[model samples]
Target: MKNRIQKLTAIKNAKKVDAFLITSLASLKYLSGYFFYFEHGLSPFQLLPAALVVGVEQQASLVLADNETQQLAFIDPSISVKTYESYVYQKPIDHTTQFLLQLGEAFKQAGIKSGRLGVELNALPASLAFFLTAQYPAIELVDISAEIAHLRIIKDEDEIASIRRAANLSDIGQAAVLRLAKTGMSELELFNLVRREIEESVGTRVPLMADFVSGTATATGGGLPTSKIINDGDLILTDFTPCLNGYWGDSCSTIVMGTPTMEQRSVFNLVKEALEIGIHSIQPGVQAREVDFAMRQHLQAKGNFGHHGGHGVGVIYHEEPRITPYNTMALQPGMVIALEPAVYSADYGIRLEHLVAVTNDGCEVLTKFNHCFQQGI
Candidate 1:
């Protein structure tokens, strides 16, 4: 946490800002190591459960709701914390009002009264923007959304561990799909079994983001579970994404429930080959676009595919270091990315994704799952 604060301080110095107000929940977790449940209705537009205020010379201050004060006990002791009321019954004032009031106090405590303050304009709410200008007329609120996002692109050791665990959960989901899915079963039924298996493995009701589509639905890339029944030889593309320990894991696999046609096996092999080529191209200092080209060009004979070849993942599901035709950002060590290669036809589609970490020489594949479509089960 101290190292992250120092990096933020360096960004402040380079940008010549007096202080930085971080409102994004992802940014809050990245800096403070405190994970707040997203399902909680704290950040409903103008109200946020927490925000980190960093001054040029003083220690960073984390402002949060009084109801969430318990989180302070787990965070770094070097950082200070301020709290606003969360539950009150007597002539209650709005949460936004209390939040801004405490935020102003946090700035004052940091000795930042009048100077240019960095703010993530994209994530900052209109209510807070007005509060800053109204409270300090001379204060300059510079947009620093891009700068803050750049800070989280590289994963630390702790973050990689969290993501690795998350990937293990995803593998559990994929295995369930093969064991529980059968002909005549609705897509929703299969999905429920997979979800139950994953939650039971973790011993908790975990938040999940995924795509469970079957048969012709796979032709449209992927979609939510429906009443569509699985038929013999039907294609099931399961892209499971489960969040464990505040980090996300992503993996995609396409399989046939019964005997696959020659076309299905051919397309599946092509996608798997493309995924392998894309992973091999990943090395420190290699441009992301080049990796995209390597896979896209390999599948050129099979025609064009949809969506990006890959992207970075961590606190946010989809982020920078995007592997596309135009992205020029170079891959760096410690960066975790999900590479997905696919081919879609009028009748069906096939996609396979694997999570990996860019290494000094090449990359390490983190996703553990079977990627073959020739399974008879």
Candidate 2:
């Protein structure tokens, strides 16, 4: 934790900022160790109350609603914590107003009254941006979103452990799909059953994203679960991404309900080979685009696959170090990425994905699940 603050402090001189006001949920969780409830559909107003203030001269601090004081336990003891009241019926001022007022105190206490402040221009709320400029007319706010994102691209030990746990949960979901999916089951039923199995493993509700499609639907690339029925000889493509412990896990597999035809087996083998080729290309100092090119070149003769080869996975499901034809970012140790190779047609489609962590010499495949159809065995 101290090292992260020092690294941010090192950037202050170059960016010409005295302190940083971290508003993005990912940044806050990464720097302060406080995992904010960042579920989707929450209004921006609800997200305005959390911030992490780190100054070059003074101590680091966190600002949040008083109701969230318990989060202090998770934060470093060296950093100060400030809070405002929340969930009150008869308050002298509204919640946003109180939050802004308390935030001003946090900034002032951090010795950020003047000079420049590094802010996440993309993630900061318009209201908060206005408040900062209006309150401190002398202070200049610089956009440091890109720098922060670059720092998060590399997973520290703590982050790697969290992702490993999340990946295990993903494996659990895939197992459920393989063990429970049967002929005549609706897509939605199988999706629900898989979700239930994941949540049961974690002992709590988990935020999940998925592509649950079967038969002809898989040919469309991917989609949400529907009432489509699974039948004998139909292929089921299951791509599940479950967020647990503030980290995300991604896994995908395609299985046939009954015995597969020669054509189905051929396409599945081609895609599986493409995925293996992509994984083998992952090594330290390798360019991300090279990985994409290798996989795309292997499947070009088939002419049925399109989409990125893979992408970095951490706090965000799909982030930097993108494995596309255009990206030139080099793969490094501690980088966790998901690579998916697919073949789509009007009749059926097959996609196989694996989550891997770049190692000093090679890569470690985090996903452990069988890649076979039920009846093929």
Candidate 3:
């Protein structure tokens, strides 16, 4: 875990702002040790605390609802916590006004009256934005959401370890899918089988997403499993995501239900070659788009391909430093990316994906799942 003070200092240096108001759950968890209930279980809507205020000087303050005060305190006992009962009306006595007033007082106490106040506009609610602006008219509000995202792009030791565990879980799920895949099995059935194995192996239910499809339905390339059934000589593609400790791992592989046709084998080999080219292209200082170009060029030469070649994976399955033609950011050490190269056709489709970590010299493949096209039940 990164020290809250170190994160705040990085934010201050990057954005040149006096302080940042973090409203994003992921960002809040990254800075503070608080892991909210919503992140662990299902809920109608995510309950977000008002805001976590971090100043350039390492000062920390949490503005939360009355119900969350104790929970936040347990997460960080030494931090200053302020509570408001904005929506908690069941209590005989409410501290809503007190919370907002204390928050304003904290700002005043910190001497942050007339400098740049960074806000996460993408994640900040409109109502909260209105209240902050109304309360602090002298402060200049700046959108620093991208600056925070930049901080999360590179993986630290702990973050990488979490992702590695996620990758191992995903590999287990893929192996289960490969073992159960057979002719006459519906895509949904195969998907559920993999889900069951993953939960059983982990000893608890976690967030696991699997997509299994074959034949013309495979034209979609990637999506949730449907009711379509597998048939002889059909190409089955399974893309899996397994989450561990708020981190994610993504990998995809194409399989043949029975015997693969010569045409299917040809397309699968082309995709495998393209994937190899893309993986070999990954290294520190290499442009992200160049990898996409190499994979796309290989597929286009073969006369079959898809739109996006690959993407970055982490806290969010799909995040920054996207592997597309539009991205120009250079790859750096500690960056983890998901590289997928696919070739789709009217009859069948083929795709192979792996999680890779960018190193000081080159890149290392993190996923060890089998990608054999000849493998069967």
Candidate 4:
């Protein structure tokens, strides 16, 4: 937590920001180590579930609803917690007025009268922006959401541990799905099997999402599981998501319902090779685009392949430092990345993904799962 604070301070200082108003929930947690579920009526946006105001001088305060304040205390005890009453409750205090008063008090206490105030415009609502500008007309509001996100791109030891556990659970769910996959199994059945296995294995209600599609549907790559049944020679693509400890581990594997055709095997081999190339490119000081290029070049050398290669995985499934041709962010040690290489065609599609930890010399694969395309019982 101390290191997180220091990293934020460094970002603030580098941007010459006096204070940063963080609205993104992940950013809030990264800074204050607090977690709160977003209430729809209060804050519907995932990006700005709650607001966190942190000053360059080491002052930090969190603005949340009354119901969430106590929950946040369990995770972060140092942050000054201020809560506003719920809008549905009819009491002496009203929700809007309570939030306004709390924000005013927090601003005043932080001595943020007139200076360069940074806010995550991408995450913040326009109405909130107008209200803040109206309240503090003298302060200069600046958008520094990218700076805060870049700071969180690198994972710490604890974060890596949490993601590793998530990956392990995801592998378990994938194995369950594999066992249920057969020539006549419905996509929905496979989905429920994996979901039930994850819940029973963890002994808790875990957030699980998976896409089990067959034949032509497989080309779509990702979608909610349906009742579509598998057929012999049909390709099955399953992308697994098992959320644990407020983080997510995402992995996708392509399998054949029965025996694979020669063409299908060729496509799967190419995708697997592309994934390997991308994984080999993970190391400190390597440009993010270099990995994307490596994978794309592999596919282009064979033929045109569909979809972007992969992306960063953390609190949200798709975070920063996206693996695409457009992004030039350099790979750094301590960054957790998901390498997914996929190919789509009219008849079938195949994708193989693995969660990797970027290290100083090379990369470490965090997810443990067999990539075989054999049919399951």
Candidate 5:
């Protein structure tokens, strides 16, 4: 978390900004080192609008609603916490006005009165951005979105540990479904059951879902679970991503309802091979696209491939250094990635995904689930 603040300061120094604001919830949580969502069930997209502000010579500050003042004080008593007029009592327009007014004051308190300031323009609301410029004509607001992305790409040790914990929780959920999901159960039932199991397994509640699919629908990246029932000779694909302590863990596996047809087995084999090929290409300094091309070539030659070979997974489910034909960023140690090489067809699809970390000479798989058709436990 200190590195997060230090990185933003480094960016501020490089850009010659006296102060910077962090609007993205992910960035705030990363820097604040507090799990804001653990006790609150709200999604980040609809969170209690909050921001973290830092100045060159001042302590970091938190801007949020007044009602959350006590909680934030209890969590971070030392840092400055500024709050707007109560949003609960004010009209929507007034709320926005007061919020912006308070935000402007926070900027001033951070010593941005007549200096360049940085904000995550892409993530900050357009109207709010306009209000900021209008109210603080003395401060130059620059978009530091790229710098924020760069800062988040390479995870620190704490982040890596949280991601691993999230992954373990995800595996617990998927394993429950695989072991107990029977032919007669509906898709939604399996999802609900596994979700409960995941919730019970974690020390803190984490968001969980199963891309539960069977029969023909498993051929694609399935959506939410439905009423469809598992049947004989059908394959079930379950991909679960559980968010824990602000970090997400991803895991996917294909389970058999009965015996797989020879042709179906062939498709699974090829997909497994593609995943292996993609993983084999991962190492410090390897080009991202090179790994993607190596795996995609196998599926492309055989036909019916969709989706990127892999993507970075950390505070956000999908991040940079994407393993795609268009990205050329070199892999670096400390990056945790999910390599998912899938094959989609008209009838159904088979794919495999596992989380891994880029190491000095190679990549280490973070998840250990039963991907074996005959011996998976």
Candidate 6:
């Protein structure tokens, strides 16, 4: 994470800011190497983690609640940490005020008391924003959200490793679907089987999903499976996304319950070709749109391409450099991407997806699952 700070120092230089406040969870997690989860509606107002502050001249600090201070020992022992007490009605301590004061103190100690500051303004909560501006009227806070997001576009070594683990988990899910999916199984039953296998392999519950689309469900663009039973000759599509640690992995495979027909095989092959060609177009220094244009143009000539060719995958499932017609961002080493090309019809949709990392010369396929049409159950 220290290396991450050094890399982000360039952002400070580019933005002409003396320091930066990282409030976005994605950026914070990227800098701190810690990922925590809270219930949907129980965060911030009910619970909140600290924001990360980085000064060009000072060590980075994680500003969190007092109760979470103990976690600093494990989260990042070397980084500085400042904490404020949790809110309590009886105790009546102003936690927000405390956080602001502590944060201001951190800035003062870092010699950034009266300098321009770069911050993720979009992630800054309204209450905190009001308090911060009211307290530190002299501080010049510049929005650096796009700067940090661009820095995250190309992942570092540690991020790649975590993503590899997440990719492996997704492969485990695809394998489970191939092994457990059988004729006459309820769509819900298939969904449960894949989820059970994935959790068992991961050794703990995660925020993961294996959407079950079978028979007529395939034509509807996929969803959470129902009690509808899968039948022979049915097309089943499983788009498994497994959350391993903080990284996300995605895999989409469309398989048939029985021997596939000639038309099915042709469509699958066409989609696979498009996916492979897109992957082949990925290399350092190439415009990201070339891959999209090649795949979309090829699919367009043959039939129809309904989705973007690929997209960057990391802390957030969908991030920068989406492989779309208008995206001209150059592909760089360390960018992990997923390429999925499909042909959707009323009867069914056949899509094959693979995760790959851009290399200096070409790209490395991160997903190890066999996407080829399986002849037997």
- lDDT per model, in order? 0.84, 0.83, 0.76, 0.76, 0.76, 0.78
lDDT of 1 by residue, 36-147 (tens): 7765545543387688888757568888888776687556677788888765678666777787778888888888788988888888888888888988898899988788
Candidate 3 residue-wise lDDT, 181-227, digit = tens? 87787888888888888878878877876666777767778677888
- Which pairs clash inside model 3? 85-96
lDDT of 4 by residue, 273-355 (tens): 88899998888888888898899888785555656677888777788678888888888888899888888877677889999
- TM-score against truth, every candidate: 0.94, 0.94, 0.86, 0.89, 0.89, 0.91
Q: Pick the winner on TM-score between candidates 2 and 5.
A: 2
Candidate 5, run of 10 with poorest lDDT = 39-48
Global fold similarity of model 3 (TM-score): 0.86
* Model 6 lDDT tens row, 151-189: 888988878888888888878878877888888899888
Q: Is candidate 2 or candidate 5 better by lDDT?
A: 2
Model 5 C-alpha lDDT per residue in residues 64-98, reported as the tens digit of each score: 76656545633345457777765453444355666
Please give, for residues 210-236, the per-residue lDDT of candidate 2 as tens digits. 999999988987899999888888889
Candidate that scores best on lDDT: 1
Superposed Cα deviation of residue 69, candidate 5 (Å): 5.7
Residue pairs clashing in model 4 are none
* Model 1 CA RMSD to the hidden true structure, in angstroms: 2.0
Report the lDDT of model 2 for residue 362. 83
Q: After superposing candidate 2, which stretches have Cα over 4 Å from the reference?
A: 1-3, 43-49, 69-73
